[model samples]
Target chain A: MIPLILYDIPSKLDGTYWSDNITKSRFVLGYKGLPFQVEWVELPDIAPRMKEIGARPNKLADGEEMYTLPVLSDPNTGALVTDSWEIAEYLEKTYPEKPIFSNKSKGLIYAFGNAVISLILPAAKFPIFRASQILNERSAEYYITTRQVMFKVKISEFSPEGPTRDEHWAIIERAFNTYKEWYDEEVGKWLMGDVISYADIFIGSILSWLKRVLHDNEWEKIVNWHDGKWGKLLADVEKECKKV
Target chain B: MIPLILYDIPSKLDGTYWSDNITKSRFVLGYKGLPFQVEWVELPDIAPRMKEIGARPNKLADGEEMYTLPVLSDPNTGALVTDSWEIAEYLEKTYPEKPIFSNKSKGLIYAFGNAVISLILPAAKFPIFRASQILNERSAEYYITTRQVMFKVKISEFSPEGPTRDEHWAIIERAFNTYKEWYDEEVGKWLMGDVISYADIFIGSILSWLKRVLHDNEWEKIVNWHDGKWGKLLADVEKECKKV
Candidate 1:
């Protein structure tokens, strides 16, 4: 059987693989025990590479171009898929025996992920974009330029200090508090009880990103918050990753 | 099988019943075909009435007092429940025949509702608070005063016209767009597919409030947005309400 090809984005500086979107596909692959080979594409090469594979680009409501990574190609069927959610759905359909999302929880999981993304976006923006520092020269330049265009501010200005930093931290704290309250009420080791699913992977990807990008003290503060559930979940994801 | 009593806040001016919180309980009762009666309480009278029934008030993280309505009294068990989510859970437990939420989807539903509340709050605030104009003299005075203190602005300033209104509308549009994108991906008739659950009820309550408070034109614009899905869902909920 031909192995599945997972296209991922590599950091420009060290060529290390790091992307929440790509992590999602990786997590699903690991969880399902799917045999896959990673094809790391740098930031500047993403569009051309994706175009060669016929992977669809995400477009804004106004028809603005928005290129993204994490495309998967199924060699068995010769099918190409893009978008993390779509890829997960594809895996579920193609490999029904190991379902990433149960039928009953599918819509809820999708909605919950959307909510998590919305809540975490503000908090994650700085650290995530700042991680561009680790990218290779060309990729770093591309990343900075694209991000500046998106945020309408210089990358340096993205770093909030003093009152601004405190405000940003407070927002992050509130987002985590919201998650913790839900977790406490649900009383689950995993997001959806004992069994791990894409929901965990989705959240775990965010936690992993934070761990990678945030300074030790900053990461320590977040992981220590929420009664250490964040840290435990991160560890659980790492264990899952190891099984792959 | 004594009828459950749902305590709701009545509008000040016409003493009519209207509240998203109360509507949640009503929706659950209606959906489950449970026998229940609403006891109308005014704003100022809410805390004392809730206290009399031993309903707990929600407190902020800072331990500030934040009293709210929608308390349910189940005569069968003599149990008093506060908070819409809590009430739904209690009703589900008490009357297991008709489930409002599936076990697997409960946490996700809770999280989704929180996210919706967060996104819609800013857009809904002005019209919601402005609806206080319909309140009776004392209740209206109480509403304005409390809201002013909470928002740190006079009630008159809440009305966004011209550019401000446009900005607020833009925010609302973005929020609905987010929901629409999720719904499109999930491909659900109801939030949780064919079966209407507490999630739908929760969202429908918000829609109902918008219908009640927003100006005819304003409400029309919203309902017409998202390819009339909002209007259709509101109609569906109204149909469900009529069944009771």
Candidate 2:
């Protein structure tokens, strides 16, 4: 069997993979026991490279074209799928024997994942400096330029200190607290139940990104706030990944 | 079997029930084919009446006491459950023959419901004036006072016609579009799968509230925004409810 080709953004400084979007795809592959090899694409080359591989841009609800990373190239079928959520769906359909979304409610999980992304984005902004430090000079320049265009401000403006950072952290804390409330209400080891689902994969990937970008103390604060659930989940996913 | 008693806030003018919290319980009962009767309680009377029925104030994550409506009293088990989400869980557990949450991942659904609540709160706030008009004078006064305290502003300040209201509506429209993106991703009739779940119940209740408070044109604009999914879901829920 040919190994799947997972296209991901390479970190500038370490040449290591560190994207939440790519982590999501890696998680699903790891969970499904699918053998895959990474194809490192630089930050600036993602769009053109993905398009060269025949990966089409995903259309938003308003018909806006969105090009993103974590594009998967299935060797056996010669199928190239783009977008993390779409890749998950493709893998689930292609590998029905090992289901990521056991209940076939990927929509609900996707909704929750998007909500988490929105909640985490504000806090995630505060860690831009740390994120930039890990990027090589070229990728760092690309990252900062794109981010500035998106945020309409300098990357340094999102420093992880002072009143503004505190406000963003507070928003993130409230979002997690809201999640914890729901988690506590249900009797489950995983987000879905005793069995893990793509929701866990999505959350685990987000945590992985935070772990990569946030300082140790900052990471610990968030991990501790959710009654150790976040830490435990990352550990659980790690254990699950180790099995394959 | 004795009918379950559902305590809800009464509509001031119509002497009807219109609370989203109450609709959650009603949806469960209707879905389960359970016999239940609404015990109308005024705004100020909710806490005392619930206490009289042995429903204690719900404890928040921070251990704060919260007194809210949609309290259910099941005579068969002498169980009193407060809070909408809790009531849904109670109903599901007590009457397992007809399941509302088929996935057994109530936590995920609850998280989605809470996200919806947060997203809709801003847009929903615009309809308060219309909501107040339906309330009796006493309940209206109580509602205004409490909302003023909660929002730290006068109730009249939340009128539907203003630049601020448009901004709030834009936020809600974006939130709904985000949801529509997820909904469009999966091949399912409901938020979860082929069958309706508590998620649909929660969403439907919010729609019901909007329908009750907003003018025909305003409500239509929102209903049309989400690819007609919102309007369709409410209709589907109503059809499902009619079965009981």
Candidate 3:
């Protein structure tokens, strides 16, 4: 049987996948032990490629549709899915034996992810801005240009230095600490007691992405925060996050 | 065994409990089959009562701590709990039988509650504004004065009669429909599949509030929304939401 195909974007420096969104899909595939092949689509070519595959484009905040990567195609079932969340849903539905999300925890996982994201976005803006730096020339240009429009600020102003940057990191540190409390309350190593599910993958995706994009010193700070909670989570999922 | 004492407020029409906040604690107590007694504390008297019981005050937006109702004291454990969410936590911890929140889903339940509350609070303004009308004279004055400051809108302007009200209800209907999809996808009648938990109680509390405070026509519209999810949930919980 032909392996599933994952559309991913590569880091310009090494021509390997570096996108957190792409990593999210990759991690889920690895977790389920699903055989999948990766195809690199540069940032600029994503729209046309998505259009070619009939993958759904995301609606931007202003109601404009924008194409994105981490598009998954299942050769076995002839199913195509776009967006990391939808890809998780499609994979879980088509391949149910090794489930990423049990029916009981699916909605709650989404809710938990949303809550964490809303808290972290202010701090996350820093990593997102840094992420644009990893794209290949044309992809980098496309990413920066589009993001500037979306962010309504130049990339230079995105993650500032001094007190403002300190505040961002402070918020980031505090946010991680805040979520650690949830994990602390639980009985098992995973978020949902003994069960390992999509919430772990979602969080692991963010941490993996941060590892690749953040400066070594900044990354060190994260690794140390919450008694190495972020670092340990990355370690836990790193095996399943193998490059396709 | 001395029954748990729950501090509550009553409607002026009769000295019976009509508060959704108080109803939430009552519902949980009933669900746990824990015997509880209610003592009515008029709105004006809530602060003194809470202070007297050593129940913690809720911090306002500006960091001012203010007393509120639904303060529960467990005579068995000598535990004094304030806040509905905390009350759920305390009950589950102290009782440990017929738990409102299982250890695994507790954090996720909180996450889901926050998500729903964030969406509903705007539309909920109508009922909250109306709630003041049910209070006795001094309580009514205290309720309106505190709320008008918190809402920063006069009671007259709180739930306006034109396009703005339409927009608010539209948002309310849309929010319920959106959450209903989560329930629809699940295998069981409850939010988190077959296992009933605090998420259901949280949703039920808001629905109970709406039923008591919304106009007949407005409440009817909610009863029919999302295939009568609101109405059915009220039915499901009303048995437990007794006037203790």
Candidate 4:
């Protein structure tokens, strides 16, 4: 009878959501019409709090623990799922009806989900830098500090501005262009033809993140590419999942 | 109805097959229970011959026309499908029976098929060199000559024996290992769980090519990796498509 709780880290500015994965999980919840409450855990508290709630850390290659956002705790299933893709799997498993992943293509969807992430990460430096800007003061501090150490450069140094930022933007545009070629013909307004599936959700989620982060002019530049493909898809997502 | 004609490049040794793509197309034909005849086109003649048959060339980035194999001409529909993924789409659209692609996952399957090829291409130097060794005399000569000119190295120089070949093999093994990590559990033998789809066919075709080209010891080494995952999948493919 109780609603599910989605654990996410909130931004400082009016506690708005920012992470692509969190936005995706929210879309799933909204799409499924699942009653869910957002339980905002600040970045610093996420690790200790998540572990306290028996949710495990995402292990790095070198055995380091990585506590991440968008951990969905389904009170109905008495399970806490971590990682964006894993959260998708958990939701699909728990809520069989209103399924995002088609049974026939669940495995392929998983691969494509990973593929989408890979495509996004190549030009992610800008967004990665911008991400810290939206976080709460302490979380932003934690983010800038950790990421600076991680990249051996200040967050500002990553994206810089002007030509360098433009190069990163071009990479993203090119990546999406490569994806645009995947369409044999633009018959339907979706990846799986007329049907709206997880494939759309995956890319749309990232698009949503970019839309939220990028300045209006930058977002305007993107929405124009491929005859406004990204613009149209985001519109469809918003129309389909109003709660998201 | 007259049988469909699959245009392919045959290896020299008594007209044996060696191409990954042609083999994949063969798998599709057999799996669909469609009657098809192989029309062996020599390597040098493929572009001109295909152009004569009203089949188009796959253009390179430089806009040069490059004709490739596994072009399927269906006498029934009067369709000449070029490229492996395009062939898959054509077959699915035309036959619409005994479907290898689940309509729900067709888009994702295409993406996964492309992913499989990308994973295979990095360590393809050995296979690229070995490919010439199997071709007919004129074709082998043409292949070595063209490819040597392309790479600015003799065919023998590309995949020279010793540690270099070993390193190339390791890349392939590591690629497959990366794929192995994609699976969350060892539940089913197939990529899309119990059901075999185009994703399996794509990778299986590459495995078949490797098996045909690699020495028994080298092939055995691959078959043993990932707990005989590649070996078993190829077996399943062969069993499913006897003609292939």
Candidate 2 root-mean-square deviation in Å? 2.9
- Candidates in order have lDDT scores of 0.78, 0.78, 0.79, 0.79
Error of 4 at A36 (Å): 2.1
Number of the top-ranking candidate, with DockQ as the measure: 2
Give the range of the ten consecutive residues with the poorest summed lDDT in model 3 chain B: B235-244
| C-alpha root-mean-square deviation, candidate 4 | 2.8
| Listed models, DockQ each | 0.52, 0.67, 0.47, 0.40
Residue-level lDDT tens digits of model 4 in B3-107:
999998878554488888888888888888888888988888998899899998876655787899889999898898888777877887888787777655566
Model 1 bad stretches (over 4 Å): A12-15, A60-62, A160-162, A241-244, B12-15, B241-244
Q: Tell me the tens digit of each residue's lDDT in model 1 across A1-244.
A: 6789998877633336667778888888888878899898888998988888788897665788766778899989988988888899899889876676765567678878878877867755567555877677888889889888888888877766877677778878888887776665555687667677777888888887777666779889998896788999988976875534
Q: Give the candidate order by descending DockQ.
A: 2, 1, 3, 4
Per-residue lDDT tens digits for candidate 3, residues A1-244, read 6889999887765547778788888888888888888888898999998998898898654578889888999978888888888888888888787787764788777777767776688776698788888778888898899889878999989888988788898888767875786676567767777777787788888888888888889899889887787888888776644544
Q: Pairing residues by index, what is the TM-score of model 1?
A: 0.91
TM-score against truth, every candidate: 0.91, 0.90, 0.89, 0.90
Task: Judge candidate 1 at residue B168 and give its lDDT.
Answer: 74
All predictions: root-mean-square deviation over Cα? 2.7, 2.9, 2.9, 2.8
What are the clashing pairs of model 1? A12-A135, A12-A136, A13-A135, A13-A136, B12-B135, B12-B136, B13-B135, B13-B136
Worst window of 10 by summed lDDT in candidate 1 chain B: B9-18
